[model samples]
Target: MPFAPEKPARLTRRRALAGGAAALGAPLVTVFAPVSTGAEDQLAIRSDILNVEAMQIAFDEDFSTLDVSAWGPGTRWIAHTPWSGDFGGARFANPGERSPFRIVDGNLRIEARRDPEGEWQSGLLASVDPDGNGFSQQYGYFEMRARLPEGPGVWPAFWLIGKDRSTATAEIDIFEFYGDKPDGYSSVVHVWHRDGRHYSRFHRNAVFVEARPDAFHTYGVKVDPDWIRFYFDREFVWKTETQPEHRQPLYILLNLALVDGPTRDATPDPSHMIVDYVRAYRLD
Candidate 1:
C-alpha cells in the first residue's frame, strides 16, 4: 500500500555526490560519470570505498530459517485501509490469528500489534506466491539488515515491487524508517505509466547516527542497467537515472506501517521491525 503513485513530476536531480557534499561537512569525494546510455557503464563514486565487489551472492536470508522457500507469509501480504488500503495508520493482519509475523532468534520480526478490538495488527511480507507463485529479480544487489522501531506511529519498510501487480508503477524504496524521524530515512524510485502517469526518484536523508534506534544498520539498493544506487552503512548515499526503467522481475517487501504522521497518535503498542538480513546480489 505504500507503493505510492500520482504525486510525481519534479525529480530529475542526478548530480548529487551525497547531497551537496554531505551538507558542507565535506571530505568524501570521487566521482566518475559515463552512463548516459552509450553504455560502457561507469558510475564510480567512492566516498572512501565500499563498492561491493562486482556482486555475486544472489539471495541470502539470514532470518535463520523461516524461509518459506523464499518468503510469502502474512497470507501473501494482503492490505486494507483505503483502496487496497494500507498506507498506514494500521490494518493488515491475516496469516493466522493476530499474525504480525515473527522468526525470533535469527530476526525477522515485523510486528505493530494492538488488537483486542483496539485494532492495529500489522506485518506484511512478500516475494510473491499466493497463487502468484514467487521470486523475481532483474538487476540486483538489494539488501536489508534492519533494527528500527522507535515509536510515534512507526513505519519501517524495505521495499520493491513489480512482479507485475497489474502495474502500480515499479517501486523500490529500500528504506523508509519513520519512527518520528529518529535520524532520518526514506528512499524511493517509482516509474509507472499505463495511463496512471508517474516517475519518481527520492532520497530523504538526515543521517549522522551514532547508533540507537535499535542499532543494526545497512540498507541498500543497486539496480543496474542504467543505475539506481543508494546505500547507507556501506555509504554511497544516493543515485538515480530515473525514467521508465525497471525492466520487470522484482519482488520483495517488508512492512510495519502505521503512519498518519505526527506520531499518528503516538504509536507504541507493540512496534518492531528487526529483520537482521535479506540479501541478493548477482551482477558479476
Candidate 2:
C-alpha cells in the first residue's frame, strides 16, 4: 500500500518550578499543524474533477545543481539532434554545456535544431536508472506545465520507461506535441513491452486552447491503485482503468525530442519546449 505524506503535530510543554529560584519556568515548546494525508491534499484537476493528491515542485529552479550520481548510469549521454544516426568520429556537443538544455528565468528550456543534413537534432533527457524509482508503484499522480514551440516535425514528450530491459513494465505519456500542428497535443499510455515490441492503448486529440507557443499549460496524470486519469490545463481529458497492473513505482522523466515518427515527417526548425515545472505525487 502507498503511504501518504502527513503534516507534523504541534508540540507542547507544561511549566515547572526551578530548584533554586522560587519561580516557575516559562513553558517552551513548538507547535506544528498536522501534515495532510496525500489523498486529502488535492490539485484542482479540472472544473469538475479533482486529483486526490499530487506532488509539487518535483523539479524546479532550485534543482539547479546537476548531480550525475542522482541520475541513472546505464544510458549513454549523446549530443547533436535526436534523429541523426550516430556516425563515426562525429564531433558531438557537450551535454552539460549546450544551450539546448538549460535553466533560465525559472523555467527549463530545451530546443531542437535542424542539422545540415536536413534532419532534426533536438534535446533528449532520458533516464539511466535500470530500476526507476516508481517501477514498483502501482498508482500515483504525475503532472507537468510547459509551453511547446511552433513548427513541424517537433515532438515534445513527457514520458516514462520501465527498468526491465526485457519487457516494458508500463509507459505513460503526459503530453506529446507535434510542432507543426500547434493547435492540439496528445496524451497516451502504453503497457507490457517485450522482445523489442510495445503495445499502446491511449486517448488523443486534446486541443490545447491556450496559445501553446505563447504560454505554459499544465499537464498531469492521476493514478490510483486501480485507476489512471489524465489532465491538461486543469481539464480531465482522458482516463484508463481497464486492466490493472499494480506492480511497482515508476520513475519520472521529462524530455524534448525531434521525432520523425507517425505524427509528422517534416524537419522542424529551431523549436523549443519551455517547461515551467514537473511534479508527481502519491496517494495516501
Best by TM-score: 2
Query: Candidate 1 regions off by >4 Å?
Result: 1-43, 46-92, 95-113, 123-127, 130-135, 140-153, 160-173, 176-181, 186-220, 224-228, 231-250, 257-284
List model 2 lDDT by residue over 88-181, tens digit each.
Answer: 1112233554446667786767766645774445555443343343222335666678887776555567764434433334566677766666
Reference-based TM-score of each model: 0.31, 0.63
Candidate 1, clashing residue pairs?
A: 81-85, 82-85, 89-258, 129-133
Best by lDDT: 1
Superposed on all Cα atoms, the candidates' RMSDs to the truth, in angstroms, are 18.1, 20.5
